[model samples]
Target: MPRAIGPVLVEGPVEVVLPDGTVVVSERPVVALCLCRRSRRYPFCDTSHRRRSRPSVERPADGEQA
Candidate 1:
């Protein structure tokens, strides 16, 4: 039998029946809907939660003061 796990979290290849009597299918092993509203793919996880790199620090010259 098929069922929904949570509001946004669902198992793979879940079949969603729209209000218009249309059916939508997901073919992934696991479907993670975007809650933060930052995912480019929307309603799917594209690994966009990774942190960004920091700016590089500048070092002093050989004869620079302590």
Candidate 2:
């Protein structure tokens, strides 16, 4: 019998039905739903959970300070 996986993490395609009767389909072998509302792919985790690097603010050497 076919059954729904979860809002939890899992592998393989997933079909999500919204309250408005909208159906969202994902065919990824490993699907990650966004819970933090930070994913650019909204509802899909595009590895946005990874830490982002910030620009360095340290000054350059005296001779290289152009």
The best candidate by TM-score is 2
Model 2: lowest-lDDT 10 consecutive positions: 1-10
Model 2 misplaced stretches (Cα beyond 4 Å)? 1-8, 52-66
Any runs in candidate 1 off by more than 4 Å, and if so which? 1-9, 15-24, 53-56
Report residue 17 deviation for candidate 1 (angstroms).
9.0
Model 2 agreement with the true structure over 1-66: per-residue lDDT tens digits: 654232348786988676688888999887887665566775776666664688887888888964
Per-residue lDDT over 1-66 for candidate 1, one digit per residue giving the tens place of the 0 to 100 score? 564332366788876665588776789877776555456765564556553477887778899964
Task: State residue 28's C-alpha deviation in candidate 2, in Å.
Answer: 1.7
Could you tell me which 10 consecutive residues in candidate 1 have the lowest summed lDDT?
A: 1-10
Which pairs of residues collide in candidate 2? 12-29
Q: Each candidate's lDDT (Cα)?
A: 0.63, 0.69
